[model samples]
Target: MNERPRGIESVLVVGTGLIGTSVALALREHGVTVKLTDQSPGAVRVACELGAGDEWEPGGDRVDLAVIAVPPQFVADWLLDLQKTEAARFYTDVASVKALPIEQARRLGCDLSAYVAGHPLAGRERSGPGAARADVFLGRPWAYCPGRETSPRAVAAVLSLIELCGGNAVKVDPVAHDEAVALISHAPHVAASAVAARLVGASDTALGLAGPGVRDVTRVAGGDPDLWTVILSGNARPVAEVLEAVATDLAAAAAALRAVSVDDDGAIARVTELLRRGNAGRSRIPGKHGGPARAYAVVQVLVGDRPGELARLFQVAQDAGVNIEDVRLEHAPGLPLGAAELSVQPESAEVLAEALRSHGWHVP
Candidate 1:
């Protein structure tokens, strides 16, 4: 058989955590030779064991491209040293924030011509390669920031890499990237964490009453605090700037609640409007990778844990000429009843609920 084209053949992935290992797996799936390394020896070993990449030794033969997925604080310094050693002909990073590292690179007198800054806007609350998914970046937006010293070839290489991993590339200035993510991504993490922290000292009985709304709101709070501390600390100024606006809104809420005997209609209206704004804002968050948000119909159903209960319910939906887009099994183990939140087209939701109810399922 003829040999494959050799341009940008070998790629090195530094840091074999969730992001790094995921990148390696995605590249390897494209038949690209991937070399994986990490500061944690066990992590590297685990990544290799999980088929992320071939084991890589430090100061080895230079690869065509190097993707550094280290934490934000270390990216700039690491890139500087790698550039000095000519570790790779082209370099990019997967750090959430970009401007600080880019500035640090320039200060270190590294050849910026060989580097590009990139961020993949995809992650789970979980950390490490064990949580890495090959399709993690599929259809997701990957931001690219080209420095003045970055070469056209390097930019192209990174773009191709993003595409190979099934991500769409969006170019923006490094500073803009940081600020945008501060609003959309970083800010949400802090908000989720804060909300979750408030539940820490709550009574067990109070916590037992938690529902899906609370779970969804606090989901990202389960993320590694150590990692989040680095991310928030690295982008402190931008994140703090966004938080100040949130604080102002919160203060307004507090003042409204404290107003005694005053006609609180205006304050109540403001709160309601704020909640409405939240619904509008949340609807704009791209669904699954630039797709329309997954619209769900809340189907309140009484379900038993008996065998074939789920299968029978689904069969009824299928028979009703309704397609179930997605299903959330919300049930407490050892309980006889549960609710299935069915995510379906708005048009089909009512039909499915009716059909299920007709089939003797208590679907509200």
Candidate 2:
């Protein structure tokens, strides 16, 4: 937080699903008066019970801002209705697909002057208010796409909301936002689902050999299918375009693999070239603070699968004055031991490793 943000002391959060409830909870943490509502009264009650906000009524007083967190298809209609009633001075939506919503708003003849479309590039596999967390948006990119008719005041208020929620606001055009998300978020989620779909009725013997890599690759596939179906449908064309490109690459890789059996001279090169391109693409993903990835030295330590093991290891690193930049845990099946991979600065790696070794931890 570079500066203290000030805007929208009171907010009406429409749709108390995961994103809405999370935004409400985040706003609540910043002392904003959050009034929550959803189509389902039970959802609103759950969010309110979680201290996200108070249950909003139909004819409540106009608030400084209103956040519509409904699915993409309904965002325009919600914006239209809210603006018609002057429910808030300014409004924004958290739907991931931006272009369609903005276009739909235009088609519906809604007032866009006070509305900005936004999408926070952060979420959990779980949906609903019970899965919402105040810190979910911390350090994540919150994109706001202002239409041609949007007012500067509305944009500023949206930026303030993003800041208050501990997110970095990224200003982008609506169509460009859709394309970018389609490539990164939407396409990848569908790809993950496709991969996970292969596991249906898979043998236990095959699944037993799985490791962290498979889990990481298929993690997003666990998201709600109905919700994702709506998301994929909203951004269909862009997502389809990206998926087509991916399918082409995958088809080529498979062909190259098949060629290997016939002893084709170029088969290995073809597959290797695809792998190299994948490495290049993976490296291009932004790291901390939307910057280039930094090389951190990983210190691996074998630990007993017991309570307080990770805490003790972290405490050791703290006492050694070595800040662990990141951490990943590895579980050993059918064994009471696992490995903790601690990422630290190159200079501190040896110090942290030595500290753990001194604490009777196996640094293998």
- Most TM-score-accurate candidate: 2
TM-score of each: 0.77, 0.80
User: Which predicted model would earn the best lDDT?
Assistant: 2
Tell how far residue 359 is off in model 2, in angstroms: 24
Error of model 2, residue 298, in angstroms: 12
Candidate 1 residue spans exceeding 4 A from truth: 1-7, 260-265, 288-364
Return the TM-score for candidate 1, rounded to 2 decimals. 0.77
Whole-model Cα lDDT of every candidate shown, in order: 0.80, 0.85
lDDT of 2 by residue, 226-287 (tens): 99899999999999999999999999999998999898978879889999998888877643
Q: Mark the 10 consecutive residues where model 2 has the least summed lDDT.
A: 285-294
